[model samples]
Target: LGITFDNKLHLSGHINNITYKAFRTLNAIKRKFRHQDNDTFLTLYKAKIRPTLQCASPVWTPHLKNQ
Candidate 1:
């Protein structure tokens, strides 16, 4: 697991990490597949970006309203 934790067990770090990774992946896909059709771009997004955002979601899900 690549999840990161602080002294208080807050998930902000983990959330930030995954979002950054997903954004980077999305940018790469956009650059490399700029001319591709929607279906192809969607396929690439599903394969590459979705997982980064959804990884280990259940284990680290926020329980507090402010989290």
Candidate 2:
């Protein structure tokens, strides 16, 4: 699993890691598909960026309000 934990066993590190990866993928898609139409961009986003953000979600998902 790609999930990570801190000394306190918090999922913050895993969340941050996935967030960074997702944003980076989004930026890349924006740059590479600048001329693409809305439908095409949506497709790309769903196929690429969404997966990065959603991967291992059940394992790292926050249950506490402060998390």
Candidate 3:
């Protein structure tokens, strides 16, 4: 959950957690729409996962190597 440490920015753990959560949400959506086609899942992914992962990007993103 940490984005900065000692003036350094790290994303390994943060991205991992985000991916996990997004996957879980996607799975739930899939279960809810088990009979839906790929298009439906794709749309749901864009609507749900995209926003959750992109939230507060400026705060978590690193602008420089030294961060």
In candidate 3, residue 55 scores what lDDT?
69
lDDT of 1 by residue, 24-54 (tens): 9999988988899989988998999998888
C-alpha TM-score for every candidate: 0.87, 0.87, 0.62
Distance from true location, Cα of 27 in model 2, Å = 0.5
On the 0 to 100 scale, the lDDT of residue 40 in model 1 is: 98
The C-alpha local distance difference test score for the whole of candidate 1 amounts to: 0.87
lDDT score for residue 57 of model 2: 86
* RMSD (CA, Å), each prediction: 1.8, 1.6, 4.6
Candidate 3 lDDT over residue span 19-54, tens digit each:
688889988997899899989878998999998788
Tens-digit lDDT track for model 2 on 1-67? 8789989999987887888888898899888878999999989989998888888888888787865
List runs of model 1 lying over 4 Å from the truth. Answer: 62-67
Tell me the TM-score of model 3: 0.62
Higher-scoring candidate on TM-score, 2 or 3: 2
* Cα distance off (Å), candidate 2, residue 37: 1.1
Q: Supply candidate 1's per-residue lDDT for 54.
A: 81
